[model samples]
Target: MKLLFSLTSLFLLICSTALAYDNEPNGFKGLKWGTSIEEFKNVYPNATLQKQQPGEYNPANIITYIVPINESKLSGITITSPFRYSFYNNKLESVLVTFTGKDNYETLNKQKILLNRMSMIYGEINESSGNNIDEFIPGLSTSYYNFNYCWKGTTTTINLNGSYKEPNLSSYLSISISSVEIRKQWLSKVKPIDKTEWSKIRKNIISEYRSDW
Candidate 1:
């Protein structure tokens, strides 16, 4: 009995160590952000910035930023939340943005702070769009749009999108899970997003991004 108990404890210790290592975030090596147009072009050798046409509402047209990761991949960030100041006003608005590249999952995960600000902007849009209070709650109305990142080797494609509802001053937001696919061909080799290990990575990314705010 003593020997059996020792073996069990040893197994548990190994399991715990494996879990901790798996949960740890894989530190990224080649990611950089550019705060200005010239800096962006310097990092992204082929990037170009263009001004918005008169009377056009191109949110990204104002600022130019770039991120270069890996040999043949690039990422960009454009500050598009027009209702940035209404975060404290309890308003509603709409948000639209895009990300592209292979390792963008980490970069996008780091963008949750921006997303929170965009949510505030969405609150403003809902109010200006004349959404009736009876029809929808100000803080409750939110939409999430995302295109799945392609795996290294797979023909299958995954698309993810959802809408969330969180009433004003509420801590918990209700997310409408529109679609989730985890199959052998595509996302099987990649880590599952809902898993606990991925959650830890996500939490760390958000904490780092919001450190200033």
Candidate 2:
């Protein structure tokens, strides 16, 4: 009996390993990492491009495109949620899908479908939690979220999360894919500004100017 149990355990472990390693190439909706902005538009003509104003944390001239679900297609599935694509330095870097509606079950079903489809392509989910609300406050009539799902691959990371807020139910899913070099360059462009250090530098400059006078 002991030997038999050990063999079964070993077999299960091997199968799990195989499932984890079995993944499709790093791409979503026919758009691969490093796809040019013009190429993305050519593929999805209905997508609307919008430029975000540069800020301290996001110094790069980041541009985003909103692609309606009706215009884009995911293999073996149909989703009606809008997709938001962000591009930095003219290259696609991330994609986001958000769903908000009155029906909680419907939103959850949709999220499940999406996660299953992504799993088929990206292999078994890396980590997941919070599929349902943990607790509800009666007087305030508020629901708390304990829900999040995530998957990571060699070149991409995907997240699916849902939350319920009083009147409406909402869910969010996103994938970020990029090559190591591209990610490094993008990070360099959007590095956060050190506010405290900046203040100190400004103060020093001001003090120096007063002394010079």
Candidate 3:
């Protein structure tokens, strides 16, 4: 009986791992991870570069593009055109867009409403915590956050964060999507590279990603 139970547990473990890998987010929007820069220019011809030209032949490893729009609305929330596409070594890495200073609500209830809307599409929340009204003192609601939610895939992380700090103040919200494999190598704690293979190791990292959580 013990042997049969052990076999079942192992089978379940393997299935879960396979499911996670299969369902991992491969790309943002229409593009996939490791896409080249040339394709970006060809597809999004109007994407404006947000970098100063390098002094000489050294190419910029980190590049960002800001897509302009008269007005943009995401998830029924009106937003402006400051969406971003950030890349490292000409490969797409992450996308981030922050919305602030709109005619939005000044209450945490609005955030709860938005959270419900997102949960419908993204499924479950991975991990979330925030301060409640009871946790704050008699009058320190400005810094109190009602809630936060995060959804995680095997290789991608999506975060929804932002809130109002005061009455009559703008409620800001930021949504970010990113690749985790790239961030992992960035924060890897391996020993120093060998002098004999310094160039080879550097090339490998330049091609690979080092992401941060």
Best by TM-score: 3
Residues 1-213 of candidate 3 have per-residue lDDT tens digits of: 112112221221111111122244677768876777788778778889875322211122457787764487667765544777777767876676655444334334335555677777677777565555334332344542334456666777666654444433334455666666653443243343455655554444434422200
Candidates arranged by TM-score, highest first: 3, 2, 1
Off by over 4 Å in 2: 1-21, 51-59, 71-78, 129-141, 167-181, 192-213
Candidate 2: worst-modelled 10 consecutive residues by lDDT: 9-18
User: What does candidate 1's lDDT look like per residue over 99-182, in tens digits?
Assistant: 321222332342343334434432221111112222433344443222121111121111111111232221111111101111
Clash pairs for candidate 3: 182-209, 182-210, 182-211, 183-210, 183-211, 184-211, 186-210
Model 2 steric clash pairs: 130-146, 130-147
**Candidates' lDDT values, in order?**
0.24, 0.51, 0.52
Worst 10 residues of 1 by lDDT: 83-92
Off by over 4 Å in 1: 1-45, 48-135, 139-188, 191-194, 211-213
By lDDT, is 1 or 3 better?
3
**Taking the tens digit of each residue's C-alpha lDDT, what string does model 2 give over 1-213?**
112112221221111111223564455678887888999999989999654321212345557798887644454344445777777788877665554333555555555676677767667777666544334321244453434556644566555555443333332233333333345566565545476955654455445433322
TM-score between model 1 and native = 0.22
Q: Relative to the unseen true structure, what is the Cα RMSD of model 3?
A: 14.3
